[model samples]
Target: MQHSVMEEGTAYEPPTYDETFPVLPESASSSSGRLNIFSINNNLQLGRITITQMFRVPGEERKFDHSDKFGERESIRTCKTIMKETNTIIEIATSKDQSLTFLITGKQNQVLEAKRRILTTFQTQASKQISIPKDHHRWILGKQGQRLKDLEKTTATKINVPSVQDQSDTITITGTKEGIEKAEHEIRVISDEQI
Candidate 1:
């Protein structure tokens, strides 16, 4: 067989076969012609997405007490668990108004599931204030505060009535919207009965 050798300084040219075969672009010229498949796989694997959402909890932004800190810790733990379970990243920020902003990043389904679980675990609570005569405070309190405790338990709410020395007629109820409504109605009824 005859051999051909090219000079070192000369540009090498590839020999072409039949003209009927078309030349492929650099991306599609691989031996397996799987460049498009690889690109698609890259897109699927590297396509990370993020969503930002804000949730408002009704009430003034007050200083956190011990109970509040405990609740906050539980909420943080829940978020961390959700992130691990769904393979998502969650960033939570608190606004001056006590609203929470959550930034979740991951695949589309993972992010969505994380958001749903977080929102479900932390339902927004609202606080409402209603006024009754200071004289009616004892009626709401009942004997040794048993009535107040029962009301709180039944309504799934926290009811804060003004102290004897405070002289304020306002009572604060905090809970879910429905719970607050029910507590407010019962409190009003108790006060009206004393009339």
Candidate 2:
């Protein structure tokens, strides 16, 4: 079969890096030596998105209770670093009504990471603490803390059982209400086990 090499007097040419995309600057990486995304594929998702989060501090006096509010305005300012780590930009506006408005924008992954980090960092989260006998701490911790790790993963919580040396009886569970409940229940059950 005889076929023409070119159609419409135009021949196919493979795309060069410069043609397909722009050249990335060498200053992409920070001093910490983190690997930055130099360039993204043309067809790949740049992953841009915007998210808004609203927070209300309890009581109008703004007495600055740790559990009821996002903390003093200065503390909240420190959390901005978390957003920068994820390459997200944020604008926070506060009103006399004791409400805070957060506007975050960035790549999809960046936005999501920043959102979760910011909430867990500044937002008032639920926590539960239980007293487990010092002797039973080993059982809950298991060998090398594997059991505790598993329980934490399942419950989606951070369980802080004081070091065996500290002589502390409190097993503090910090996370969502559901997570705290699950972890607390599981801990009590484990401690009650006869084995």
Candidate 3:
């Protein structure tokens, strides 16, 4: 015979990113230039804080450059080319089409500028439905979610990845518009590379 078990309220509060660090103030709308210096400065003040943002645009859009041979470049070359074209920080990793995720961090305006540059370079358009796959979700999530955690620390964007059992494909990227675009492009680029 087995004894019945009793459930108790958890006294252990879950750890949180907010509680672990200080936050930056929102950037003023009046700032000039493509990059928002105030926001960037705020992030810098927050102990090397960089913003993680994502964007959703049409996938097929791009600026035509007949001079460069993108297909001929190596993986590192391709990553460098993408970074150079976007004018923002980038990291490349291998994954399936649906599993790729781009993580970006910087000032609000800088992040936005980066998104625009990347979109233009790739010639992608915003799509109503983003069919992100199941297997690739792990690359964005990283081991124990520490990759995303690091991204959050720098970009200040709250990134949520569904558990393996969740069966949901959408990776919720919460941040400023610029941040969203940057992150989304990175994801798409990585996915394209894998393909």
- TM-scores for all candidates: the values are 0.41, 0.39, 0.32
State which candidate, 2 or 3, has the greater TM-score.
2
Winning candidate number (lDDT)? 1
List pairs with backbone clashes in candidate 1. Answer: none
TM-score of 2: 0.39
Q: Which stretches of candidate 2 lie over 4 Å from their true place?
A: 1-124
TM-score of 1: 0.41
In model 1, the runs with Cα more than 4 Å from the true position are: 1-121
Off by over 4 Å in 3: 1-130
Query: Residues 53-101, candidate 1, lDDT per residue (tens digit)?
Result: 3344333432343344423656778788998998888887776565566
Q: What CA RMSD would you report for each candidate?
A: 18.5, 12.8, 22.2
- Candidates 1 and 2: which is better by TM-score? 1
lDDT (tens digit, per residue) of candidate 2 on 9-107? 687887785568544566534445455677856785545444443333333423343554454665566556776688778776666566655576777
Report residue 183 deviation for candidate 2 (angstroms): 0.3
